[model samples]
Structure formats: C-alpha cells, structure tokens
Target: MKILVVDDEPDVRTLFEQRFRREIRSGEFSFSFAYSGEEALTFLTGHHSEVVLILSDINMPGMSGLELLRHVKHDLIPPPPPLVMMITAYGDTDSYNQAMELGANDFLTKPVDFTALKDKLHAISTA
Candidate 1:
C-alpha cells in the first residue's frame, strides 16, 4: 500500500523509515513523507490515486492536520477516499473528537507504538 505521512518534525521521516524498514524492503508498504499539511496536500494533488492511507500529525506548523483531514474527507475522491489516521502527542479529547468529526479512520498517540501500528497497517493491507 502507498501511504503518506505528514508531520512537522523532520525526524519523523527517519523514524518511520527505520521502524518500517522491513515492510518497506519487502515491498509490502511504500511511504511518502511530507513535513507539513500543505506539502501533503500538494503531493496528493498529483498522486491522490496512488495513495491508500494517510498518517497525519494533528499539530503542524502551517495548515493543521484537522484542516487537511477536512479537505481529504470532503474534497478528494473518485468514490472511496483514502483512510486517514490522525497522530498527536497531546491525545486530548478535543483533538480526538475533532478528528473523528472530520472523518479520521483512526487515532494514534506519540511516541507511537510501532508494534501496534504495524498490526494496524497489516490489518488494513489485508482487508
């Protein structure tokens, strides 16, 4: 599956690359990283069809992930939209509620549990 990861932290790219190295090498999953919501949207504009899932952090520098989520859930599509999972360090109820309202498929808190994340990814891929 092709997945887009959006976060402001540059290190997130490396972290995801390292954590999912085995899956990446096995060709089970391919990732595209964007350091901000705007970048993610730009990438999606040209490659929406290629993406199956999006993992986005809620607190970004420019366009917040919630805004991005609203756009993805409402604006893009040929029918079935890509699944979006919101990530955050806060894990606050307000953010979680907002994300859900915006049509997020899942919610994950940081420091992400790679083991659990892998399982979720496997489930999505298999399903």
Candidate 2:
C-alpha cells in the first residue's frame, strides 16, 4: 500500500517515517510526504491511482486539509479518491463536522496514538 503523509511539520513526517519503517522495510507499505496542500495536490495529480490512503493535517498553510478533502471528493475520477484521514491539533465539533461533510474517511486528534492509528489502518485496509 502507498500512503501519503501530508503535514507542514517536518517532525511529524519524520515520526511517521520512523514509526512505519518496519512496514516499508517489509514491503507492506510505502510512504510519501507533502508539506503543503498544494504540493499534495500536485503529487496526487501524478500519483493518485497509486495512492491508497492520505493522512493529512487540517491546519496547513495555503491550503487546508478540509479544502483538499473537498477537491478529492468532488474532482477526482475513475478510481475515486483515496481514503482521506484528517488530523488536527485543534480538534473540535466544527472541524469534525466539516471533515465528515467533505468526505473524510476518519479524523484524528493531534498527539496521534500509534496503536489507534494502526488499528484504524488495519480496519480500513481490510474493509
């Protein structure tokens, strides 16, 4: 599986890479990074068919994840949009509702728990 991890924070990207190194090493999954939503869209335009999932931070500069989610839900074609999971440090009802309305597959609060993330990924992968 190919998973795109989109966040402006370099540490978050590094953490994800480290946390998922075993999966990469075992060829179970591959990872990509995009620091901004525009960059993500560019990557997606060329690689959407290959991407299985996208884990994105909601509060990014230039383009927010919610905006990206809207584009993916409405604009992507043929194979459909990749599973989008939104992550935000400032989790609230409004953000949650907006994400869901925009077709986000799931939402996660910041300080992400690996165990929960793993379980969600497993369930999504199987489903």
Candidate 3:
C-alpha cells in the first residue's frame, strides 16, 4: 500500500520511517512525505491515483488539512477516492467534526499511536 504523510514537522518523516521499517523493507508498504498541505496537493495533482491513503496534520501554515480534505474529497476524482486520516495535537470536538464533515476517514491524536495506525492500515488492506 502507498501512503502519503503530510506534516509540517520534519521529525515526523524520520519517526514514520523508523516505525514502518519492517513493512517498508518487506515491500508490504511504501510511504511518501509532504511538508505542507500545498506540497501534498502538488504531489496529488500528478500522483493521486498511486496513493491509497493520506495521513495529514490538521494544523498547517497555509491550506489546513480540512481544506486539503475538502479538495481531495470534492475535486480529486479517482475511481476510488483515497482514504484520508487526520492527525492533530489538539484533539478537540470542533476539529473532529470539521474533519468528518470534510470526509476524513479517521482522526488520530498526536503523538500518534503507531500500533493503532498499523492495525487500521492492515484492516484497510484486507478490506
């Protein structure tokens, strides 16, 4: 499975790489990183079909994750729309509701629980 992780934090790339090393090495999963929502949108413009899932941070400098989600769910028309999961340090009701309304498949609190994320991924793959 191919997943795009969008976050402003540089360390998130290293953390995801380390946590999913086994899956990556075994060819079970592949990942791409985008530092901002605009960057992720640019990547999706060309590679949307290749991406199966998106893990995005809700708060960003410009074009927030909810905006991205809206664009992905409304503008990008793939045969099957890629699943989007929102992650945020501020796990508040407003953010969660907004994300869901924007068509986010899941919402996760930071610091992310790799175990839960892995299980969700596995379930998605199997389904």
TM-score for all models, in order of appearance:
0.97, 0.95, 0.96
lDDT tens readout by residue for model 1, 15-120 = 9999999999999999999998889988998999999999999999889999999989898766467999999999999999999999999999999999999999
Superposition TM-score, candidate 3 onto the true structure: 0.96
Predicted model with the maximum TM-score: 1
For model 3, how many clashes?
A: 0
Off by over 4 Å in 3: none
- Ranked candidates, highest lDDT first: 1, 3, 2
User: How high is the lDDT of residue 37 in model 2?
Assistant: 90
Q: How many clashes (backbone N, Cα, C below 3 Å) per candidate?
A: 0, 0, 0
Model 3 lDDT-worst window of ten = 72-81
2 versus 3: better lDDT goes to = 3
Give the clashing residue pairs of candidate 2, or none: none
Model 1 is weakest, by summed lDDT over 10 consecutive residues, at 72-81
| Candidate 1: stretches off by over 4 Å | none
For residues 55-117, write the lDDT of model 2, one tens digit per residue.
Answer: 999999999999988988898775578999999998899999999999998999999998899
What is the lDDT for 90 in model 1?
A: 94
